[model samples]
Target: MNEKNFEYLRDQVKYTGFGEGLESELKEKMQQQEPSFSLSHNAHYGTDTATVTLNFKKSDQSDMYFFNSYKVDLQKDNSKESLEQTFYINKGSNITMKEAYNLMEGRAVNKDLTSKEGQVYNSWVQMDFKEADSNGNFKLNQYHQNYGYDLEAALSKHPIKELDTAKFKDDLMDSLKKGNVQSVTFMKDGQEVKHYIEANPQFKTIKAYDGNLKRIDNRQTKDEKQSEGQNTSMKQENKRQNQSAEEDGPAAPQEAKKRKKKQFNSM
Candidate 1:
């Protein structure tokens, strides 16, 4: 990416008031703790100056984002030049403003942020249809701003070890490939225990070795087959049940009439 495009993307990032508050709260908590922790950013947007607060667990652990929050501006500008609309983000949800806008961008141009629940939380993308002509650059396009509870992107660009499952697999494979297996610490029940292993050159042929990597199996074919068979069985069962119910429907009334006749005859 060139400097100009980099700057454009940097400038395009939007922030919101709720996101600011959450960020502040996180900072305060982190600073006060004796063993310091830090809040990371998962995703974010610009326009409303929105931000997302990513509270990670203790160090060197799994990588996951908690919730996010951003403010809402419920006012509109009446000026002929100024434009306004409602936008929002949520406190918790794996959503990004850019992703959301791309999904529903032109579909609902004139829509407002009245509906909160479908998928994008309480926020919708809004664009201010005004031009900014200041200092020398004449902005002809609409002043775009994303509104809602904002999300923050991670400050650390590099992928963390615990976060990437593939890294763990690769590390294991590389160790075996280099013939470095003798004894090593393996994670078990949140505790690391030392394990001894015999060096096998043809490790791929070993069942025990392959069994450990079975979690990576691509189940698309087997799962699809199982799903189709289950659906067929269910349809057949439902058809048989419906047919039996239909056949019994008329016989039930006839049996009732016969029982009534027998009762009358006995009387």
Candidate 2:
């Protein structure tokens, strides 16, 4: 038996979020020296359950094996049909079993991805259920750092009590980045209101939910709404002024001055 190969595969399985319990079975299968084999694992997260099958392939020219990919069969409590996705493994980084479940649940995950050119970059990845590749797998949508979605800044826009402390804030950020819908307290009307929030990187915001798990529209504040209305009015006024200038030509400046003076007097 190749002790080095067994050790490497064991570590890969553990790091990929299958835990250390599969070490013995992995060693046994590798010792058989089969050209290919697979291991199955069952995991439960809340009311959802997932069965993950890890694939292994042996090199034809060598006595080495590779842990290439994993297929996740997710059974969600709210849906009748099960969701399935295959995630490939690489030398740089791979999604964990929990992260895979989150992705299947239609949530985004933050990851440090290595480009084909060997450059490391951070991005938020979500599965596009509406599209599928030739392999019948959902396509992935990546929001790179340049996409300008700041998770921390988006969280700060809400009145979340978790962000009041350094430790709590870090914990909340970690949970949300892993695609968890975290429970938090909102300081609403000077009282603590329990709410759920999930990271919505695609929209550059956090989605809020009531205690009953119903989504609530809390994206904007009263002040922000008023500011948006004011900006819209200003834009309309500018557009009108430009139309008048185009029509009146040389006398446009005089008309604009009169309008500005009249508006100032009314103010």
Candidate 3:
């Protein structure tokens, strides 16, 4: 077995959110020198359970192995039917296990994706549950940075106390970007109320929930409304600038909007 190749695969599995428990199994499989193999893991989040299958394949030209993709079979505790999605691994940005669970649960995740030209760009990706491809994979909707969904600005609309502190605010943003429904304290009428919030990139807002996870109206204050108006104007100007840039340069690729119709199964 190639020690260097083994270490790379081990780190990939660990960083991908499977943890270090699979290191032994991964090492054993690598030693077998198979053309390809897969590892299965069961993860639990709240009442929902997920079975993640990680796919690996040996390089044709070298002794290296690649961690290609993963399929998530998510089963909610209350529901009999489960949803499954195959998330492809890319050299740029790959979603973690928890992020996959959140996406399966219908939440958006922020990622820094690499373009074909090797340029890094930020986008918020969410699965479209209403649509599916030929392989039963849900289509992904990407809200690029040009779409004007400012997460920080959205969070500022609410009286969230967590945003007051630099460290707490950064942590909350990181959690929300990972598609987690983060718990935060909302100051309403000078009283601190506990709430849960998630990033709603498509709608360019933050969704708030009560302690019981019930959706509540996140009414904007007068100052917030004024701020939103200004933001709207700025977004419009930015949109115009982006349109001009696109017109001046080559057309932007539509690969993000396209869905492959090929049939695939979990190995």
Q: What is the TM-score of each candidate against the true structure?
A: 0.16, 0.81, 0.81
Residue lDDT tens for model 1, 1-267: 123432322222233222343444454443453233434333332332223333222233322222222222221233233222223333333223433332222211111222245432233222223433343222222111243211111101111122236575456444332223223343333334344322222111111112232321223323433554555565675566556657789675565556557755874
Clashing pairs in 3: none
Name the lDDT value of residue 198 in candidate 1: 21
Better of 1 and 2 by TM-score: 2
Regarding TM-score, does 1 or 3 come out ahead? Answer: 3
1-267 per-residue lDDT for model 2 (tens digits): 678988998998998899999998998998999999999999999898899999999999899999999999988889899988999997677898888888998999999888889888999999999999998899999999999999999887777778889999999999999999999987654567888989999999888888999988865433343454565566688789889989999989899878878866985
User: Model 3, range 157-202, lDDT digits (tens) per residue?
Assistant: 8878888799999999999999999999976555678889999998
What C-alpha lDDT, on a 0 to 100 scale, does residue 205 get in candidate 3? 91
Q: Give each model's whole-structure lDDT.
A: 0.32, 0.88, 0.85
Give the distance in Å from residue 168's predicted Cα in candidate 2 to where it truly belongs: 1.0
When summed lDDT is taken over every stretch of 10 residues in candidate 1, the lowest stretch is: 149-158
Q: Is candidate 1 or candidate 3 better by lDDT?
A: 3
Query: How many angstroms is residue 64 displaced in model 2 relative to the true structure, after the best TM-score fit?
Result: 1.4
For candidate 1, the per-residue lDDT at 137 reads 20
